[model samples]
Target: MTGTPLLKVRDLSVGLETGGGMRPIISDIGFDLAPREILGIIGASGAGKTVLSRALVNWIDPPLKVTSGSVVYKSQNILDLPAQKLRMLRREIAYVGANPAGALDPTLPVGQQIVEKLRAVAPEIAHEEARKRVIDLLGAVRIPSPQMRYHEYPSQFSGGMMQRALIVDALVSNPAFLVADNVTQPLDVTVAAQVLRLMRELTTRFDTAIVFISSSLPLVSDAADQILVLAEGRVVERQATKALVDTPEHPYTRELISQIPKIWTSEAVAIDLPAETRKPIISIRDATRSYRVRKRGTFASYSTVRAVRNVTFDVFPGENFGIVGESGCGKSTLMRLLSRLERPDSGQVLCDGQDITRLSGKGLLKFRRDFQLVLQDPFNSLPPRTAIGAIIEEPLKTHGIARGAELRDRVLSVMREVGLPGTLYDELPLGLSAGQRQRVNVARAMVLEPKVLIMDETLSSLDQTEQFKLLKLFEQLQAQHGLTYVYISHDLAMVRRVCNRVAVMYLGEVVEIADNSRLFFDPGHPYTKALLSAVPTLEERRYKPEECLLEGEPPSPIDLPPGCSFASRCPNAFGRCHKQSPVLTARGNKDLAACFLVENTLSHAAA
Candidate 1:
């Protein structure tokens, strides 16, 4: 690391245009990034970390302007730079935002897009050379089969994969500095670890100074050399990663630290329903979901992608059941089946012991009233033009449950239940913050008074404080309404906190199933253990490099390996593991794991 700084910000403040003139968003934010240094900027969702990042790059869009700030890059004030010079500066300083989908061009192939970006920045580079660099960068980001994935569009990639692709895009130009805005938020722990490792490698090899922005303190603390804590758009605390984590001086910083979910410790108490209510509220019996995708070159010939393969599990009444796995592991696909948004190709989806997989017409419509789905992106899930009141009331109206004053009363009641202010009832969803929008989503879901609520990565996008608040709200709602939740997420830390029973899935198969404490603390499956170990914690800044690091990306669900789906990556895989698939069997007193090693251990103990 050099004494000379790569980027410097002084007295930075940003403002948004409002009816009452300019309103301050971020005020008096100051920081410096030295060569090869990682500065982690962490705060709640609206804390203006993103605004500061955008200001540093001079990329703040209209209505949100840099009111007072001087961002200096290599002795040059970026805000004062001319358009052409600014463009050149941007080539040396890249920014990757939280939303990868927005960064990418949906119409173009991802690889082609990267190549285009390379050529745009360096016009002297040949197409062939740029293409090679694109593939190499993709590989560097741990994207499997870069050659094939290069030709695929952004739509074809999962959220985590898309985020990695954006990272590659940022690094493609070999920028001297990078602003990684919540890059690891969507990724599973394993992938996030790999990405962070790659970023560290870049800093060491190329001296790329980075500003790693995130909502989670522990996550950034693991990767960053220095930590800057922001609250209400101001820098509340700034310290070395260790110093900040060891003893956060600010109350907000301390509260943020306290909220981070720890896998090593168990604070979760299983919510036990009465014996009569403990029966399966929702059951998936050998459910399979497949999609036909056209071959790379030929439109006529298509191959089947088995997203969910023979997945079976039961969600008991009044209990939070979690399904966790890496991206493309069928967690979301299975949730869709439970929500009746998609029908399974085979097997049955039983609700209260009655098959609802093939329900249609009135049957399907009526069945929907019994359950609701809360999606990952609440803003997208809700209609932009519709008022929050109408959005929440639509479900109740569709079910023919109420109307007129009664409908408005029910909507207001549900809104209150989700902690949404009554004043915001007539306001459009666009006017609400991310957390508020999510609350609106929850209110809409609850308006029908559904017995089952399927939350598919709902809280994954929110900041830690918002997530904690929503989690608490979920518990209260469950207690008050007797709601049974089917929570599907890649966030194991969250799963550990909110779930009563948890199931670990890999490539569409359930590899492990146990109570939250057992699954996280004493995972029987190697894959489960690896996932848990990958999670970053304040106690351990860096996980042991050699321990529980997965070998490669998960094999394609379209053409899975002959034996176990995770066998190739499993450290304990043997001859039988390669030849045969292991079924979920008892591994401990109350846990089930689909691993030959676990089975062998159990057999030896019995003998």
Candidate 2:
């Protein structure tokens, strides 16, 4: 490493103004990035991960002005630099993040986009080489069929593909440093793992200093040499990744670590918790869902894809059962089916073996009362026009249960349960912080006091402190009211702490079901193992790719493949796995793992 910094951010303070004045989001925060080094920045959402990243690039918008700080990059003080100098520095020494919407002109083809970047940075380059360099950069980011993809517009590509193209565009200038902000957010686990691997390799291959910004710790843990943990715009912890993960000193950091999504592939609970005291409320029996998709064209043919195939599970009364999977793995769709938010195209969703899948009207209403859902984004889930109190009372009004004075008391009580006081009852969700808005969403869902709360990434956006409070509150609520939870999230570690059993979903199917202990300690499915491998550990300073990084994008669900849903990507894939679908078979202690490998290994153990 050189003596002087590549990018030095010193004593930076950012403020959040409300009502009439400014409050600090980041306070006297400082960090550095050296040449050929990678720095991972982790913080709970709204803890200033986004704020600090923007500040580093001088992208922080007005009303959230920088109070005082100097961002030194490329041998000059960036904050002190004149606007033109700063702009030049951005092109010469550093590259701000590539916003997919902002990076390329939407109407133009992707090939032209790459050329524009090259021409912008080095106008002297000839047309032939610039175009060739476009293909080379495209290949560098692992975009398949570069020739064909190059001609496609940004709109024609998937979110993942667009992100990759943007990454290519970002690096076309051969930047000395890279600041990647949530570049992997839109991708599924397999693709995300691939993207992370590519970024690490590119860093090593190009020797570019990088400042990686993300809300996910494990995602960045392996890739970062040193981690800068920020909270409310202040540096909470800065240390080597391994030391931080092994013995996280900060209370906030520890909570953040514990909140990662815990995946369940088989039915094995590590420890006994005070479980709920009721019969199995929801049951699954060979349930599956398939979809038929048709593309936009004059002669587009309809195609069918089988998503959830022969899946079976149970949701016990007052017990939390978590469902985890990559983006394309059909978790959200399955949850929606279970809650009757979306009707299944095939199989049965059994409520006490009554096949609630076929119910409607009164029967459906009764079933709906048993379970209520809260989506990932509360701002989207909650109504903008409605006051918090009214939103809470809406569910009760629909059920025709509570009225007038009685309903108001219930709403207030639920709000208190979720840490929202009476003062917030009439507040618009717009002004409230992300955490507070989520609180209102939870309060609204729990007001009628449903048996099961289906939270689809409910706490994804909150900072550590807020997430901890909410998790603790959830535990308290479950214990007090005997509520069953169907929590869905991407944070595996957090899932382990809260849920007793987990069902692992992949490509629209439950590949494995296990107790939290067994799944984390001895995951059976290849995909499960790969998922665990991708999780960042503070203990390991250097990035290591998954033992078998899943290969290929998930098959198009519209037309679907036969046999195992993971056949296309599974590293241990055999002829049988490719030819025949595996069924969820009985393992000891009510645990189930659906791979032929697990079946073979456990059977061999028994023999």
Candidate 3:
């Protein structure tokens, strides 16, 4: 490469020792990241995106080892360097990993983890100096109240916060380049957007080149300057982001882009309860799920953690209703409540106009068919030991239409339907790619012919191509079988693509619900606006980020605010927002929001 690009690789090959044989992971891959270029590496899970990143970082763990490759970091051959020397170089070239949880020790306080990293990179710096640098690093990643939060364990922090902490840890070295591998996957729309914006700002300020690798095409398209598409552990296509996105030369690349969730009619709409049907499929009235904390040896010994505080919502037939919020906002808890996985402390869960709140034994088993949950992480969610074929057939065996040979044929058919080849039936979950495993997850959930599929961030781990493919499949299934969905995800972009309506959740309750188109273009709640504005759009516009009407973190869900949950983050929140909890009030046809701004905005927009 001309004048030695910051990180240069030539003819890289990585292989894993399996059955006493070296099986190739990545073959003959080569790329360069110059000082100014942020190269986006786009690929599906099996395409070896993470493997390639590991190869570049020279951090390939165990069984999967790099056999032959020359990874030159700014003219120095990192392969030739000693472990100590490589460690020194790593200080100059950081690696931000995929599993944010594994990067840090869960037991250690965040402050200590970051300080330790700083000390490792900067050995000469004193402990106190390193600690300040740690807090400064926290600020760099936009973590709030670093002083108070420095001692908190990883479990105490949100998924987005944990990721931000890891980013801060990576940036402690002030590296010349950073390898961000699926960094945006764990975050919500607002957090993901802000993190990317901060990363962009940091890259400029620090003049750091980033090798941004992700399964997301839309994110890669929006964030990266250049694009590299990988398939089957090889480079399939490489070009500038705009050129590649507009005119993708590869058929695979073309298929990948078409799958990203976008609003069908070009506007984000809120979840609108259907008017034709008076009675909803599932209804919750005054739902409240509270947990009491009791410690050993105390008179009082406990405090109550109210997860769902008088929450109420309805799900209609064939509706793709969504719940959007920060982590621990009780969205998931509420989901479990609605699905009857757990009983609400006090509320009525009416199913088909019957109060099935205390659904026990046989009744709950029947309800399971009505609602099926597609999980987030396919690796952990899928049975690793079982064959892919058997995994898909389990639901059928328990509660299915066919029997014996008929069931086997149906399983194979379902496998093909979800894009998993029939031949992959014998394959274990470990053998398949991340995307392939997720396909199996989809297949297993769909195999039983459930009426309502509860998708819990099912598309989070997939590349944009795979995501679009699955989403399109959902559309087909919905059209043909009239499958309803309770789609739960943090990716607002994807939410825009599939859902007819959405509900924004913050701290265990629905803050807003409406038609998707109106919600996107004209967000009502400050949180909704912040969330919508945070999504990194491919379409550009002249806008100032500081003009966003939101800031600050929501109070701990364990001890929530007395008034509106978003008051701390809302710029428009006055005394009313702080003093009285705003309920979801009707603002328009099939639209509602728990905010004061919508009243003013709706009136003004009408005027």
Across 72-119, the per-residue lDDT of candidate 2 in tens digits comes to: 887677666778866676554544352355567889889887787678
Candidate 1 lDDT over 238-304, as tens digits, reads 9998888888899998889888876665478568676753679899999999999998999699988
Model-by-model lDDT, in order? 0.87, 0.74, 0.77
Stretches of model 2 off by over 4 angstroms after superposition: 16-22, 44-46, 80-174, 182-192, 215-218, 242-279, 539-546, 558-562, 602-607
- The stretch of ten residues in a row with the least summed lDDT in candidate 3 is 536-545
Error of 3 at 175 (Å): 2.7
Weakest 10 consecutive residues, lDDT, candidate 1? Answer: 536-545
TM-score comparison, 2 vs 3, better candidate: 3
**Candidate 2 overall Cα lDDT vs. reference?**
0.74
Candidate 1 stretches with Cα past 4 Å from truth are 540-545
Q: Give lDDT tens digits, candidate 3, residues 456-524.
A: 778777666667667778877777777778888887778877777788887777888877776777666
Q: In lDDT terms, how accurate is model 3?
A: 0.77
At residue 408, what lDDT does model 3 achieve? 87
Which model scores highest in lDDT? 1
As a whole number from 0 to 100, the lDDT of residue 397 in candidate 3 is: 78
